[model samples]
Target: MINLYEVQETNKMIEESNLDVRTITMGISLLDCCDTDVDKVCENIYNKITTQAKNLVSTGCEIENEFGIPIVNKRISVTPISLVGGSCCKTTDDYVKIAKALDRAALEVGVNFLGGYSALVSKGMTDSDRLLIESIPKALASTERVCSSVNVGSTKTGIDMDAVKLLGEKILETAELTKDADSLGCAKLVVFCNAPDDNPFMAGAFHGVTEGDAVINVGVSGPGVVKRALEKVRGEDFGTLCETIKKTAFKVTRVGQLVAQEASKRLNVPFGIIDLSLAPTPAVGDSVAEILEEIGLESVGAPGTTAALALLNDQVKKGGVMASSYVGGLSGAFIPVSEDQGMIDAVEANALTLEKLEAMTCVCSVGLDMIAIPGDTKATTISGIIADEMAIGMINQKTTAVRLIPVIGKDVGEMVEFGGLLGYAPVMPVNRFGCDAFVNRGGRIPAPIHSFKN
Candidate 1:
């Protein structure tokens, strides 16, 4: 089945197309580690995580070397700390302690990041959920390599306006606390609607209660590969364009499937899924926006951009599904502004706005990711942005998320650099309109009529 040309083609994809395994994530369950005593729970967590992920880093490296493929990161995701510490953590300080423990474990395992400091409060917040929401500011500010997320809406539960409003204030507080770092803490936190449990990507990944004790998930990305394939069909009809993308996606996802199987067997853990998302990077040629342009769009955010994105997203899924039976997570094209170089350029050109980006999310994986806004923007306005996004996901019954970074002391056109994968972005201006009254009158927005499936 494997031929010399196939081998050569794959090598070219890695060597030039910037194709690589974005992450090999080990998801460990911390449900059994929960204890009524906060410190005791921390000890259990640190022990369990370190023990389970001890070989994760080395295994990832071994695979990369053997296959001659580049694996960018080896990471870990665990049961939500909110659930693990909810019963015992009485204050924000208590939650910060757990974050520190998680950070320590990540350092020991040699993984760059650890996720699942999260709470799910789509309909209502429990006492513990409220505690975790309040603690996010201090918890993220104090820890390194620990990523957090909160689910504030879902198709079945509707939007939790109470949590959304609180999160706006908490996001501002987090920025203030980490102002010296260019409000870098907000980059590690994500707010979501219909957040996926099996996502291998960070800032949103949490080992859900539905998962097994341990598993391995692989996220594959290849914007450059897709772009290169499209070049062969330049000026092609829409029919030709769709086929080119789908065939290219099939090849990209096959690599991910091989990596996932190898990791699961080596770790003696069950294999989870392959997430074939076209996640772009800050690197010049490795951009999803470039792929859109290759498909005939002058620039992303121009009219027809959404239709171009929709075609790409749908084809990626069609091709990927046939390659792997167990495909899950946010398996579509990602449009994170800061992380993608083309998006940054689009924003700089004034071709893209927050409102237009919101429309794109209707077809992309996540919404408002790594987007930097002016520090002077009001919390109420942030809440309004989130409410609109949540409404989109809730109605469509799809997974969507928001990760807006409000840069402290930075106004529009000012740049904030978080470097590395978090990249840098110019602070965009938020509309100076008031949404205080709507955000302040907090209550749950009832689930859509379609949610009554059972």
Candidate 2:
């Protein structure tokens, strides 16, 4: 199991190819923290999360130093707050208090972000779910480290158009509340369809009701490594290109597996899955868009982009599954404009448009992500966009999400800096044609016919 050559290769990837563990997320279930009283629920949630994740950040640093691998973020995910506050949170303010409790716990444990300020209402919204969702704008506006998500559609339960319509309004409210920070609160909120139970990514990760009390899930990324490998086979045939990507992905996943195992053993938490997503960053070389360009496209949004992305996504999953038995989450390439320099370049060059990006989401890892629009865009337009993406995920039976920021006081071509790993983005224009009538007719869109397997 110990080989010098493999070790040297890994080191080279780390030092040159931008290989790094994206995040090591600890999923902590907060179901046991629920109580009949609001105060008790807050106390229980704070105590549980702090106790469970006390050593998370330190352990991550320890692993990084020992292995000489970069661990970018240490995060925690708790069970959806809607469920945890069902019995006790009778008002929106009650739910906001729970969010404050979660934020305090995150700070006490030294994690950068804490997820699971979430509500799952794929088919229908319960009273508690509605309350938590309604409180998101204030909750995010008030907290520093808390992130929120709402699952409004799934293959089995169809899309909850009611929730979709409500989220459109809430998202705008969130933007206005955080307008001073360039509407940063909207960046921390996500709307999902067919959301997975164990995604380690931010703005979307939550400890699903099905998971255990505690587990360690690691997300590994290497878009730069994949692009560099592709460069070696420039002009090679499709088969050669595919093989190169597969072999490279296998190697990368192995590194994540090692880290996940080590983190689990050290933290005494059971190992979850390894998410081998080609999650790009603002760094020059670490871009999924560049990898597509290397695949013979003149630019990322040009013809054959979807085919190129689909091929890459499929091969990555194939290779990742071979490296580890439990490969889960959004295990494919992510295309976020702010996070990836190449995508931002494409947007500035006028080669990538909102329509093109939406088409690409059909094949990429997640849906339209980290995109900023004008401050004056209508709430109905946002709801329409969310409905379209949700329909895609429900029909395809794959995880899809939207993290759009309607930057307050910003318009087309204006840049909003989110800073750090979130990078920056130009405010892209959305279609002005109204969808008021379509969005106003609210009810569940029935599950696809293919969902009748039972």
Encode model 2's per-residue lDDT on 336-453: one tens digit a residue: 9999999999899998999999999998789999999999999999999999999999999888899999999999999999988999999998999999999999999999999998
Model 1 per-residue lDDT tens digits across residues 148-198: 999999999999999999999999999999999999999999999999999
Cα lDDT computed for each candidate against the true fold? 0.92, 0.95
Q: Estimate each model's TM-score.
A: 0.99, 0.99
The Cα error of candidate 1 at residue 2, in Å, is 1.7
Model 1: ten consecutive residues of lowest lDDT? 422-431
